[model samples]
Target: MSLQTDDLLSVQDVHVGFGEFTALDGAHLHIARGGITGMVGPNGAGKSTLFNVLGGQQAHQGGRVLFDGQDITHWSVHRRAQAGLTRTFQISREMGALTVLENLLLAAPQQPGEKLWHALLNTAAARQHEAQAMAQAQALLERVGLWRLAHERADSLSGGQKKLLELCRALMLKPRLVLLDEPAAGVNPVLVSEIADFIRSLQAEGMSFAIVEHNMDMIAALCDPVYVLAQGKVLTQGSFAQVSAHAQVVEAYLGGVA
Candidate 1:
């Protein structure tokens, strides 16, 4: 299917494999800018694999990935990130030894003036940039509701808090597009709602997101034009209500809902 003008990310006939196992078979999807899109399926349905490919974490065997109209099929993960793409893993990837503020600082893209030679020769400039980065980090921490715990070690936070920190770090990069593996997994109910609200707030701010989540309720709440994957490919896509009522989706979920 062709993507509309509002689409920010597109995947066409993409295929991914691991040794003898093929995880994605001609999978296709589209995510509009400034909105949320959910990918839902049963276990081992290639949801995570597709996320990796789109994020440039894994190479695809065929097809292409386009972001903001540029082909990024061959881009490395860091390169893609530099080009305004970012993602969070299903399991939080926060460094245990780093404080929350430190994590945010690390996520900030390094400035050319932060190099050793520039720091030694242009001390004033380096310090000025450092101050700016620090201010930005503080604001992000507050935005994600983690300012009070900014100095705490990342490992000390609860699962829900870690997820929040991850979100903060992703935003610290000022990403235009974010692929979230599972923002609500392992999070408490209160925190899940907070995360959902944060997502909506970001969407309001013009960020685009592609989320892989199993929580149907969360999908119904956050996603529009949801895509359902089965056997490594898109089985169907439509509004949440439409996909929920699809006979094929119902059969895919439970032999038969009847």
Candidate 2:
């Protein structure tokens, strides 16, 4: 199928397998620019594997991936991130010992000080990059209501806070599309709402997202074109209300609960 003009990430007939197991079978999906695309399915429906494929962590044997009009199916994870694609995990991957601000600084793409020669010479560029990273980190922390904890060890934060930190780290790269595995998992109801609000705010600022989540509330409230996967393929794609009413989607994902 032809990718729409507004589509940012396009997965076309992608296939993945490991020995006898097929993780994805000709999966096709599109993430629209400046929109939040929701993905929902039951366990073993290949959601995480799909995320891995998009993040360049998994190698697919067939099909193509296009990002911003570029064929990037073979790109490395670092390359993808540099090309404006980044992701957050279901489980927070924050550095436990690092201070909150330090974590974000480490995520900044390029720091002159990271080079030994630049550090030895104490280059002005290094100082400037570091100063800029610090300012960005501070602003992000404040936006997430974590500025007061910027100096605290990342490990000391609550589960929800750690998720926020992970999201912020991904944002430090200034990515255009963020693949969120499950932003609401393990978060308190209040914090989940706050995180949803934060995501909506980011979307308003023109950041696109593809979210895999089981929290139907967040999916229904934040997503427009929701895709439901079953047996390693898209079972349906539509507004939450429409998909929830589909008999197959209800049976496959909600076990008739819907």
Candidate 3:
């Protein structure tokens, strides 16, 4: 599909391979600005590989990635983050030793204290910026219902809590778009609801997201324009009801009869 003027992220005819194995074959999708997009496919369908490609973790053999009208096919992971693209993994990336509040602080972009000279020579300005980051982090933690445990180490969080923390950290970056991998994978029903609610809140405030998930409930609840991938290529794209009723989509999940 061609990229539209309002698309926040787009992948055009992307390809990836490893020796005899081809993980992705000319896959393409567009994430509209300020909207949530869902990606669902079976295991080994190249979903994860596609996420890596967009997040700058894996290099595509061909095609290009455009974010906000800028070509970022060769951008590095941190560069992508700096340019308003950030992601959360299937596995949490929290710093176990750090307190929950500290983790959010670290994720905030461009802390002045990151430079040695600023830490020593510009203590006043560095503290001002840090105080602002701390305020923002606390606000996010409170919104996610984690301010109660702000002083606790990240490892102390349960699987669901860690997922929430990951979401909170991504917000600290003020990302224009976030690639979420299974936000409700192993989370309990209560926390799953919380995650979904949190996402809806963010979406209303103009945060765009592209999520990879297996939970149909979450997908149906949150996604508008969903992309269904089978055998590494998009099988169909539409609303949840439309794509779920597609013949190929059903056959992809439930093997077709001979």
Candidate 4:
């Protein structure tokens, strides 16, 4: 694909390794602004490893990651998150002790209002900011259809609800690019549709996504340009139909299904 210079996320010649084991070998990918892209491959194809690198959990041995035209290759995970690049994990991280709303509120950016001095002397401003954060959190929860369970402890939510809650937390960051790692995993078929709808809704609102999923159906339904990785390198990337029909992609990643 001919990527535009306005792409929101770009990875060029990215190589990541864990000592002797190499995860990504000169991997290159990009996501356009407001686009939903899918990354698919078999287990051990380095999809999750790439996610860790991009999300700042893992370090890359070579190349760079550019976000919103800035080189953020060396930024820490929290710094990248603060800069509008957020990701959801394959395993959910809902705090059992915290309520759903509390989890969302924690995801909100901390400001000067959170300082002890500001809280004691600038009560009015702090209250105003807290109220705004609450309103934003509630709106995000409602958007993800979790408002009804806002008061419930996050641990009490079902698998699908927890997945939805994760999405809500990521949205609270008001991210420019979201890297979703199997958002539908552990979700029921019914709720999977809901998650898909929620992702579409977010895409419509000017957010971009690069999703890693094993479900071809979900990729087909949600992703535009799909990238197939094999042995830690991109095998092919195109529309669902185009990539699925590629002979090598089918043989290497799709198990002969084309």
Candidate 5:
């Protein structure tokens, strides 16, 4: 298939295996620029494995991955992230001991102070950069309604708050594509709505996303051109209404006719 310039991320015929087990089989999908794409499927459907492959956390045995028109199938996680792709996990991965503001600041790509020489010799530049990063972190915290908790230890935040922190940290990179693995899982209904709204607000500001979520309502409300995977392969791709009605999707999830 021809790669579109507007596709922020593309996966073409990717494959992965674990000894005798095949976790992914020729998974082909793409996240369009300025759009929220969702992935859903029954358990053991290779959703997480595919996510890992796309995020450069797993090595795929075959196929290619393209990001903003560059082949990144073999890129390192940090490399891919630097190239404008970042992701969050189903379980929050916040720094427990760090304050909320500190956690977000750490996700920013580069800091002059990060290099010993820069810290020692480039004091002026490092200070300026750190100041800018701190300002940006404060703005993001406020945007997500977490400004009041900026000084709170990350580990003290509730499950939903931790998820929000993870989301904000992913945004700290100003990523072009955010791969969210079940942003709503384990979150309260109110917080889930808040998370969904935050994503929509970001999408409006031109950030693209590829989310893997089981909340059908959330998917229906936020996604377009959803992809459904079954038994390690793509079963279908379309609007939620269309995929939910597909015979294969129904059978895969319910073991019966649609």
Candidate 6:
């Protein structure tokens, strides 16, 4: 397929292997600017591997990763984040000892997260940038209904709450595109909907997303031009309706699960 001018991220003929096992082989796809792109596949279909490649956590043996029309295949993880590309994991990475508010503050670009001790001591945490980060953190926590739990240790929150915290922390970077890995996996149905709403709102505000989720309900609701991967390659890509009707896609899943 030809690349579009509006494509924000593109993967070209990507290949990744370990020792003797091939995790990804010539994987390619594009995420449009300001779009919620969905990726769905069966277990071990290379979804997470692709995310790792995109997030700079996994290096591909061959391929070009273009972000915002620039080559980022050689960029480091921190460089990717600085360039407004960030990701969240299938598991929440919240610091168990950090307070909810502090978690967000720690993610701020200007804070460097090394001042958590000073923040807790209420010393040197009032610097101009720190104060601005605190304000930003408050707004994010409040928007996610975690403001009430700002002072509480992150581990005390529910699974759904932890997911929200993880997402809010990612937002602390004010990213242009976020790679969400299974945002609905461990979340309850209601909170899954809430998370979906939050993502949609962010997309409306011009943030793009590429989500790898098993939740068809969410994929149908939020994503367009959904890509299906199987055996380390893209099986097909189209709207949810189009792919759901694909026979190969159905066979690749647990009886239409994909």
Number of the predicted model whose lDDT against the real structure is largest = 2
Task: Return the TM-score for candidate 6, rounded to 2 decimals.
Answer: 0.92
- Total clashing residue pairs per candidate? 0, 0, 0, 0, 0, 0
Best-fitting candidate, measured by TM-score? 2
Q: Candidate 2, TM-score vs. the true structure?
A: 0.96
Expressed as tens digits, the lDDT of each residue in 1-258 for candidate 1 is 776788899999999888989899999889988889999987788999999898888888999998888888999988888889999998999999999999988888766544777667877777887788799999878877889999999999999999989888888778999989889999888889989999999899989898889888889999998999987899999999999999989888774222
Error of 1 at 199 (Å): 0.8
- Predicted structure 5: clash tally: 0
Candidate 5 lowest-lDDT run of ten: 111-120
Off by over 4 Å in 3: 112-114, 256-258
lDDT (Cα atoms) of all candidates against the true structure = 0.88, 0.93, 0.91, 0.88, 0.90, 0.92
Encode model 2's per-residue lDDT on 180-227: one tens digit a residue. 999999999999999999999999999999999999999999997999
Better of 1 and 2 by TM-score: 2
lDDT (10s digit) by residue, model 4, range 119-211 = 678778778877988999988887777889889999999999998888888888889899999998888889999899989988988889999
Residue-level lDDT tens digits of model 5 in 1-258? 989887888889999999999999898988899999989998888998998998898999999999999999879998898888999987899999999999998888785235667667768877787788899999999988899999999999998899899998988888989999999988899989999999999998888999999999899999998999987899999999999999878889885224
Output the TM-score of candidate 4.
0.93
Q: Which residues of candidate 6, in runs, are more than 4 Å off?
A: 111-126, 255-258
Model 3, CA-based lDDT:
0.91
Residue 89 miss distance in model 5 (angstroms) = 1.0
